[model samples]
Each structure stands twice: as structure tokens, then as C-alpha cells.
Target: MSNPHPLQVERRGSGVPILCLHGHPGSGSAMAVFTEPLSTRYHTLAPDLRGYGQSQVQDPFEMADHIADLEALLDREGIEECLILGWSLGGILAMELALRNPQRYRGLILIGTAARPRGNYPPIPWWEYVNTGIAGLINGVKPGWQWNIDTFGTRSLFRRLLKQHTPTAYHYLAHAGTPAYLRTSRHAHRALNTALRQGYNRLADLPTLTMPCLMVAGADDINITAQSSQETAQTLPRCDWHCFPNTAHLFPWEVPNAMNETIHAWLRQQNL
Candidate 1:
């Protein structure tokens, strides 16, 4: 296999290692609020995956390459084993990692992740076209249209959508402010295209996983539905599933404290 770009990591605290992975179009910084609080008890390491944040950009962002990058990160850190807290795309990668090397993982914390590819080509919403057109027009006339759309515009739209589900959580995400390194249009498109082309589905393999897992979903998640998480929970041998009412796909960002507390409590119960 070819070498991947060197991963940029944010490390804090000292104790059991816990790797934090972020979603597509997001950087390790996006996960900072969630990982930072746990620093006191657990050694938290969040990395910027290839083409996102401070990490080097590379073409052909295949899932295999991501898995390899993670392996390299662990080897570089000299971590024999650690726990994983994955959100969205990160959650998918975490599952893949566990399947590839179960012994290296102590437990899994998956939030708003699907066990398999929901479909080859999911339907694009009609509103998205309108949003794109509006964004394009604004960008054409304005100098910083791209940044504005990618940052404020995108976050605003998500905040509105999330508000319908969880008002308090929406407020939190709205104030977080989008990071510049996280707004990657090209990388997002490439990653999604690769996953679709590969027919990414791990549903069948879910039953084979024996490690302790915690699956969380937002009841009103528009991206990955809660039903998918429910099904995943049913398939896993030792899994705890929780669906927060009136919460959306960005639950991790919206309610970082709650999510962190829940994860910490679960880890204590598992003695990990």
C-alpha cells in the first residue's frame, strides 16, 4: 500500500488513549469541544484526516487509504491499544478499524453513523438545489462568497434545521463557528463519490464484531436516520444504543457535554 499524508493530531491529558475522529467536511478541531473535556481523565488524540484541516491533501481518498493512515498514526504514537469515539464518517472508519484489528481496540463510541451504505445514490433534496443556486449567485457577486457559503451559510442552514429538532442544541452549534480548514468542497465530493462507487456496506459484518460498542443517534437526524442505528444495535452482540429525542445529526456538536458525560459513564461501566 502507498503511504498516506502525515496526520496532524491534537493531543491533551494523560491516561488511557482515546482517538477521536470527525465527520466529512470537518477537521479534528470540530471535535475539540467533545474531546477536550475528557482530557482530565483520558489521553485524547484527535487527528485531521487527509485533505482536511492541517493534514496534507492527497488524491484518491479511498477508505483503504484512511484505514492505513490510522494504522500509521497508532504506530507513530506507539499506542498498543486504545478506545475510539467516532462521529458520522469517523464512526464508519472506526467500525472498519475494529473489524480489521479487533484486539487493538478496547471499545467503540459511534454517534450518528450507519453500519452500511444506506444506498448507492441517495436522492438529493430539492431545497439543496435552491441553496446551491443562491450560494453560487452570492459567490459570483461577492469576493469571499465561497468562504461565506462554506462557513457561515452552511452552519446557519444546519443550525436552522437542527433548531426544529433540538433548540438548545442548535444554539450550541450556532455559536461554535465553522473552522476554515473544515470547509472543503472538493474533498467532501471526492469522499462521497468514492464511497458510493465502492458500494460501502458493513451490515453483514456487524454481527461479527465482539468488542463493546456504544451506538448513539439523534431521533430527527436527517442524514443517517435513527432507524439505522437501531438496526445496528440489534445486530451487535454487546452494544448500548441511545437515541436522543428531538436531536439531529450534529448531536455531538450540539450537546457535547451530554455526549461526553454519557460516554464517560459508559466507559466506567465497561471498566475500559
Candidate 2:
């Protein structure tokens, strides 16, 4: 599964490198908030995995393709060893990479992800249709947000409404309409979902990742419950786990400062 294609990376700062991997339906830009602060102290490398963002791929691919891309990416970057930070789908990739060759990574930071996904890929929830229609109606008048028919492909309405009724709602809503998000390939989205549905269980491999690891999850994240992260942490030999209260799957964006502080403190304590 050697991918000759090099992933498009977003690199920043210098010194120890930290490879930041974004979740499904996300590009390297999604990790900017977390990587920006860390870049001051550590070199951060965020890459758009194939079929996502600028690293567009036309042919079909799988999880193994992504893993190979990462391995190739590190070699291309001339990084012998680095810390890996992953969110959601990115976390799964991180674990796979570490499991494949533990020595290549110094440590790991996994956020809002699970080793074993619940695999609940139901058709668009009925409520989403209602919300999208409302959002579209609102957009027509106020021009506050953009509307698209591919609600499943573009989560503009869902992301907007998830933040609840607040001034930030508009800001959150705008995320779906952003060029980066909009540019994400719908084919990439379905590929990952299909992989999950086919059964993604790495619980058995958790104990093999001996590197110092940090696992964080949002309590309110129904997509990947906090309990799943805790279970994965318990199996790991060296893991620091945390469950952020009053947060969902997108907790990093919801509480960026707190998440950043927690990661910084952990890295300091571990002397990483």
C-alpha cells in the first residue's frame, strides 16, 4: 500500500515536530486552532489526507491508503521521529501508525475519537431536513449563511445549530460554508463512512502503543462517547485521559483555550 503521492502539508514553526491529523470531512486547516499555539514551541505538520482538501484523489482508496500516505509524508518531511496529534478519524490513523511502528513516534495526542466506532450510519436524520429548510429560508432573507442541497455532504446547518442559540451560532454556521470545508470531497466522506460500517475495532491493539499518550473526549459527544476513549486509555500502558464536560465531538473548537492548556501542561509534564 505504498502511496507515491505526497500529501499536501501545512507546516509551522520549528524544533520538535508534531504531526497533526484532522478528522473525517476535515482538512489540515481544521487543526489550525490547535497547531497555531503549539507551533510557537514545537514544529507542527498538518496535512490534507488524500481525497480531502488540496490532496485530491480521483480513484477509490481506503484506510490503509491513508496510513501509507502518513508514513510517506513523514519520510518526505525528513522527520525521523515526532509526536502525533489526531482528532476523530485522525486519531484512528495515529493509533494505526503507532501500532505499525512504535519507534517512529515519541508520543500521541488523541481527541474526540474512539478505537472502535459504533458504526451508526443512518440516513440523514429527519430533523436535519427541517433544519436545512429553515436555514435555507433564513439565508434567503438575511443572507447570513449559505445553503446547499447536499446537507449530508455539507454540514452547514448541523454545525450551525449544534452550537445552539447564541451569537457564535453564525460563526459556527459559517464553518460549513468555508472554502476548506466546501472543498472536501464527498467521495472521501463516503469512503470513511463505509470503512467504519465495515467494522473498525482496534481495542485489541490499544495495549501495544507503549508511547506516552493523551486521550481526550467530549462528554456530550454522542458520535463517539467519552466512555469509549476511557476504555481505550485503560488498555494503554501510558495514557492520560480526560473527558471535557459540556462539550460534543467538536469540543476542540468549542473549548480551544482549555484544550490547548491541557495539551501544553501534559506535554510539559511528560517533558515531550
Candidate 3:
């Protein structure tokens, strides 16, 4: 593959490799909560998928592009065999990668994701988009107010919405306000969802992914319901699933310590 724009990867620690893939509209940095904890024992490689964070995408792209990028990234990194940790959109891509070459991955840590996501995703209020755009414009014009815009402007609104819709996840994102949350390309975001909406169903292929899998879901996640994760887990040959109470789609961040403990225990149990 001729790499047009080489992915920007955040690599940490050293030992067994673990490819960490972040959620939609997120970057490699978003996976820091998971990567940092495991870094002491495992080498974690988190890449900002094309169009997210520093790995900017000029033209509109689809899921295939993302898969290609992951393939190229692994090849370039000399990662012939490794574990995969994927959240939300990353989980979908992880499944695709595993299906494409099941032998490459020894295990999978999937969080807040699904193989065939069903149910209507609640739409973000139109006013939030307008408010965010205004905030972005203000920041663009007066770079000095970047922090103010992030805190008092855009993030303030995000906090309110998350508090109302997902109070548990809100607690983490509200304070952290990670930069990756704002770096995603709108075009890329739209294209990725468009592709998913068009058609994405690999339920039948689940059996092919015979590697040990640890799946975690938020009990209250409407975006991709815990039931969805349960269904996927049932199909997989070796999958240990968990659904955390009082958490939503961003449960990984909401309860990082607990999540890490679960992951570590699962890894030990699988002897990976």
C-alpha cells in the first residue's frame, strides 16, 4: 500500500505489542487512559485514524481507508502479531482487521462497540452544532481565547449535554476535555458514519475470529447498547464480556481503573 498520509501513532512502553484503536471522532490520545495503565507491561500503539487528530485527511474517506491505514501502520511498525484494543468505531475496525487476517492478533479487548449496531442513535441537538461552530470561529480568530473557548464555551455546553444524557461519562470528559475531542474532521466523521449506515454487518463472520476476546460495554449505553455487545460475545468462540452499571458508551474513560483491572485479569486468564 502506497501510504498517502502516514498515520500519526502514539507509542509507549515495551514488551508484547497491543494496537489501541480509539472511537469515532477521537484520536490516539483518547486511548491514553487504557494505554498508560498497560504500558508498564505491554507496548501500546495508538494511532489517530486518518482525519482525526494530527493525521488529517484532505479528502473524504471511508472505512476501507481506515483498514488500509491500520494494515500499513502495523506493517511499518513491524508488528507481525499483536493484541488489539478497540473502542466504538475502533472495535468495528478491529473486527474487520481480525477477519481479514485472524492470525495477526492473539487477543482482542473490545469496549463500547458492536458487530451489528442496531437501534436509532439519538441526534445531537442542532443548537449544539451552532454553539460549537461559533466557539470554533471565535477560537480561530482569537487564538488567545482557545482555553476560554474550550472551557467556558464549547466544553461548557458539552458538559451540560453529557450531564443530562450520560452523567457517568460526563464526569470524566467534562474535566479531562482531551484535545482529541475537538480535532476530528467533520468530513471524515460524516463519511465514516455514512459508510456504517450504508451497510456494516459481520455477525456471520464472528466465528472466524477464534482468538481470545474481552468485551466491555456500558449498561446504559444507548449509542451501542450493552445488549449488542452481549449478542456479539455469544457469537464469538472465546469471549469474556462485562457490562458496567451507571456507565454509558464512554465507559472506558468513566471507569478506567476498573476497566484496566478487568483487562489485566482477562489477559492473565487467557495467558496471553
Model 2 poorest 10 in a row by lDDT: 160-169
Q: Which stretches of candidate 3 lie over 4 Å from their true place?
A: 1-4, 120-178
lDDT of 1: 0.74
- Residue pairs with backbone overlap in model 2: none
Give the winner by TM-score: 1 or 3.
3
Tell me the RMSD of model 2 versus the true structure. Answer: 4.3
The TM-score values for the models, in the order shown, are: 0.82, 0.86, 0.83
Which structure is stronger by lDDT: 1 or 3? Answer: 3
Lowest lDDT block of 10, candidate 3: 159-168
lDDT of 3 by residue, 170-228 (tens): 33454333466678898677877788679778899899889999989888777788898
Distance from true location, Cα of 238 in model 1, Å? 0.6
Candidates sorted on lDDT, descending:
3, 2, 1
In candidate 2, stretches whose alpha carbon ends up further than 4 angstroms from where it belongs are 119-127, 133-178
TM-score ranking from best candidate downward: 2, 3, 1
Name every residue pair that clashes in candidate 3. none
Candidate 3 overall Cα lDDT vs. reference? 0.79
Regions more than 4 Å wrong, model 1: 117-156, 159-161, 164-177, 180-185
